[model samples]
Target: MASRSTLLKLTFVVAMVLAVVVLPPPADAAISCSQVLGYLRPCIGYVTGSVPGKVPPAVCCTGIKSLNSAAKVTPDRQAVCRCLKQLANGFGSGPVNRAGAVPGKCGVNIPFKISLSTDCSKVR
Candidate 1:
């Protein structure tokens, strides 16, 4: 039977410990669509800069597929590709979007105008 104040203090301390010890997403965890979108945000500038040019490097595509299989093979793959294509075309760089275009790590090849761009900076 702890007092209310004591129980509250204990709760707070436990919460603080959990906050410090609890981990974020694993390095190899599957990323949600929203997370993927966030990761690709900054790369927009980098990609748009190269509009009307060759697509982004294969490394970019490889990295994306490696990070999230959903980005490449899942039924949502097309949505991801389409979203990226729109972003590339809108940004005026057909190439950067192409950089993200490629088969997913699971071997699902996305066939569209160009592949999506992948920026891993958001992944911790």
Candidate 2:
């Protein structure tokens, strides 16, 4: 008993709703280790203990939190782990060890250990 115009409007509304429901969500941008490193670089002095008695700054903890969130995917996590390992190797053992402790110090619980010799391939 509906008029043609009303039926057409109803059909259009239903179609629009269905399309919205059926369409796949937009994909998230891929995270890269370089991006993660960029965030962490500001915290280097604190992490490496280069500045004696210096605790990590607020920016450092913010960067740590961002990296932790970004590396949620397995691939991103592994990439970050490898990058961290390479970065650790560039410093000597003492600094590298200190660097590994940054995440915990910042209260970020990354899944894998951060070490110069960490096997990134084993990170999950």
Candidate 3:
């Protein structure tokens, strides 16, 4: 009985040690890739849209390059594209609007604006 009790205690100690070694760090312990991505999302919209004026928001540019490094097609890229299209559409183009005007016909269809432009400059 004494030997069995000693063995059980030893096994419990080993299990605790293994648990401590194997467990992941706590959520607050460090910054993770997902957290970085989350921070970048809003910046994407601002940069792509040329917010507050013609000059792009500096924060937006910083996050986008970091996001691009991680993935070929990032969530940030999509957000920025959508924002630019929406901004362009706000300008409202005309029928046969050849002079770098956004297609007013799209109205709320931000996706359609991108299809019309080779680059955003053409739409703006």
Task: Please report the candidate that would top lDDT against the real structure.
Answer: 2
lDDT of 1: 0.50
TM-score of each: 0.35, 0.70, 0.28
Q: Return the lDDT, model 3, position 18.
A: 94
How should the candidates be ordered by TM-score, best one leading? Answer: 2, 1, 3
lDDT of 1 by residue, 1-124 (tens): 8899999999999998898789574444343556656645534443555433344444445445554554544444545544555555544444453344333322445444353344332212
Better of 1 and 2 by TM-score: 2
Ten-residue stretch with the least lDDT total in model 1: 115-124
**What C-alpha lDDT do the candidate models reach, one value each?**
0.50, 0.81, 0.44
Residue 95, candidate 2: C-alpha displacement in angstroms: 1.1
Q: Taking the tens digit of each residue's C-alpha lDDT, what string does model 3 give over 88-121?
A: 4554443213212222221212222343363533
Off by over 4 Å in 2: 1-30
The clash numbers for all candidates, in the given order, read 3, 0, 0
Task: Name the TM-score of candidate 1.
Answer: 0.35
RMSD of each: 9.9, 4.6, 12.0
Q: For candidate 3, what is the total of clashing residue pairs? A: 0
lDDT of 2 by residue, 17-85 (tens): 999999998765556767978989878887677666646787888998988887887778888887787
